[model samples]
Target: MNTSPSVPGAGRRTDGSSVRIGALVPLTRPGWVEAGRHLLAGLELAVRDVNDAGGITGRPLELVVRDTAADPRRAAAAVDELAGLGVAALAGEYHSVVARAAAARADALGLPFLCSSAVLDALTEQPTGRVARLAPAQSHGWRIYADFLLGAGHRRIAVAAEPSVYWAAGARILRDHLAPRGGGVTELDMRSLDPGAVCDELADKRATALLLLVGHPEPAVSVVKAVRRDRRLAGIMIGAPAGQPEFAEWAALLGGDGTAVPFLRYLPERLGPLGARVGAALRERLAEAPSFVAYEGYDTVAVLAEVLRSHGPDRARIAGSWPQVAVEGTRGPIRFSRTPGIGVWQWAWPPVQVVDRDPAEPARFRVLHTG
Candidate 1:
């Protein structure tokens, strides 16, 4: 339950009044610490920008930071702490599991939670007026990725998936999409099997492409490296839906093997005007380009700031205003959809892309397909 002090200029008020927002980020989780750092960076940048632009009807916009650490219990506890701290709204979570638990707590406390990066459909499945998602659901993004593969003439695909909720949801969506198109997928459990053995199995199936639904960068990178080493699997398209700008370090680890390895991402090679400005600021501040998590963090605050400006720091009003939100976001025009079967108040289109890690320059990536 560690909390960072508010940003220097944030929450400063001439009348001694300020509005506080809660940011739930994974700061100490082993696999998620770096991701949480990137997310927090974007969020802090947005707070600065919001304050500079006359924050929330002339009141300073303050962010109260809490670390979720990839644990549901911890996330819930953090939410409770943030509520006690008197935050008017909540935003910026990375892991879906953590987001789910925090969302439940926020709902119970009647706090407005603007989810930044969690993709689990269940996060928005139940009608919780207090919660809204900025990122597309896992099913929505995976269906789009599956269509991209099919459109590229890939029919016989092998899916290597992790057992996490995130990976399972994506794998199911991809399976559903492929089954209807007369294309089939061979599903492999990535957690139990050896990477080399998995590559051998895919090679035996004569698979045209290997679609990895592994959620983390380490296993995704291992699978990619293993598949590339097998001469028999040469030229096989190795694609990962979760391994893009979020895990861009995997590209550097892949070396030459990184080339043409397609992955889904929200940020494109060329960002929109808002995105470009944020990207440049992030690069200058962090000494590297921001990841998709960074963009999500930025947009979450930007959306919340807009809601606060119109609604005047009322949590109920903020929640109610989400349905009417149609602001232009860095990724695209940000708006939530109320359609059935999708998560409640989930972003209909989050501007996703299928990009490849440039082998010549591992730090850079080129967009191959956009949706």
Candidate 2:
């Protein structure tokens, strides 16, 4: 098949009109599309800001977006197409499984992928220089969450989990971190249990805390409702370490029941100057308060735009440039390093916090813990 010369990847662009970065986001059903919208909001905002001042080397920095829809196979294929289209680098992916697939393909294709979100620690089987991540790995964030559970005096924990690698990995991280500290995790497989069954199991086990390791608005919402209604489980605390409560839909669906269910969030107690400014811009663009995923998206382009400015649009140069990255991001000074157990070039961490919607004012988030 003959390729079109008008495509960005075509060799015909010797004039250097623009530098393109491929964006992988889930914008449709089955994917957490609200998160994608926020992520895209941050990415688009950064690109606009970059171009407003000046694009990389006077060429407009362009974003070629493709929907991953939270599918691994689709994400891999998008990586191939984006690579073939001559994207200088890749960014965005909220789902860890999808990001893992895209990262693996980008590594093999020599494409620099700065993953915006997706906390699975084992993002790739083998380490490679091409893929770097901005989110805290599952182990790091989940361990903090486990510590929060311990701090709250909840030693016996139960996780209502689904059959997913991401879920299983999260469970493992919680277990590993909590076991040495006298905390035990009980896994209630959501596949076999309904909302009532989960409540029954929680009551039977006498678990003090029920960590939601399942997806949102489905078993998670139902389970929360069941537990909230059951008199036996009224004293039990609920948590969502995977950040299901971070989005507005969770509160919109579960309302009062969703409040106080502490979830992991990747922002500092206070936004730095840049973070505050960007947060305002993102709020304007998104027409609502932006999620951490949005800030992640902005930081991604911030880091990449700097790399492209200093290093040009070469994929290898961008990958090689990861170690030297030092950009003032929305959250804090963003840098990359090899973190223990994490395979990609990681940002070490963004500020991790256990926050929840205040039951008194569901629109407001109250910080429960931080690290």
Candidate 3:
């Protein structure tokens, strides 16, 4: 049976037995379920591993989960709940808006927190920031994706993103990447999953290809449906790498040949011992095998464990320890840096895929042409 741990100010029981670690995640929504599950599973695995390895500072670690439902206000409320529980620190927020809100709350309470999934640039720029990101920022992803597009011989392109702050930020970075080379970029912004409206825009713009920033699978599918609605777009490519499960489904929906670029994709066997081990374990526990984000979560928690063990769980201590601990995670080598302020740019630019009727291995997608 699972049990809650005792922590400092969070009204924990008297035992003082376990060190509580809190995680703010989106668990209630259907669309974000897979991403949320993978992330939480990795954290759960890390907690279990810690206890197996004699726990942290001789005390076992207990994880307290709070469901943010991908809403900022709810995320803020979740932070309050976690902090109220006397958790030593918080970690793992997938969405940037929620993360920003949680960061604000963490700042208010002076709690040290770790955020893995929020990629929006603004989340990292909180004025009294008490947050540390273990994942790449929106700008980094945009730069890498844009660079990939440029390298892949795609000079003229169309763009669309979920009408959220994160994708908006990504669009800006993408614009920067394309403007210098040539002003041949087209922008299409979509906040709805209505396929018809988006498809019309895709045709009207004469977009040769598309880049989407929405993470949800439905929106991605909508974009493809919109594209397919116009028979003329049959040859026009649609690309979205940062968005995952959606990419796979969209490709399948498009008769298994939709184009997609993922932020991370590497066979475990090719990734070396640590990568192989993490990948193998994830396959066993998760109902669905690990995706890039899943491996990323596993890697993030592993790195966090390394940081905490080496520097202790004290927020101040762990913050200082980030500079010293570097690891080659599933996404490749990553380490924190204070200069750029977004932590570290460890992972590689995502991999691309062409949807096929069979869709190939969930792990295997057709590599799109890229530099």
Best by TM-score: 2
Candidate 1 Cα lDDT to native:
0.81
Q: Using lDDT as the measure, name the better of candidate 1 and candidate 2.
A: 2
The CA lDDT of each predicted structure is 0.81, 0.89, 0.63
Worst 10 residues of 3 by lDDT: 5-14
Q: lDDT of model 1 at residue 233? A: 87
| Candidate 2, run of 10 with poorest lDDT | 1-10
lDDT of 3: 0.63
Model 1 misplacement above 4 A? 10-15, 244-246, 268-270
Highest lDDT: which candidate?
2
Q: What TM-score goes with each of the models? A: 0.93, 0.95, 0.82
Rank list by lDDT: 2, 1, 3
lDDT of 2 by residue, 1-371 (tens): 11112222222212357789999988886888899889988888888888776677677778888888889999999989989999899999999999999999999898999999998988999988889999999888989989999999999999999999999999998999999999999999988999999999999999999999887668788899999999999899999988889898998999999999999999999997888899998888888899999999999999999999899998899999999999999999999999888789999978999999999999899999998
Off by over 4 Å in 2: 1-16
Which 10 consecutive residues of model 1 have the lowest summed lDDT?
A: 7-16
* Residue 114, candidate 2: C-alpha displacement in angstroms: 0.6
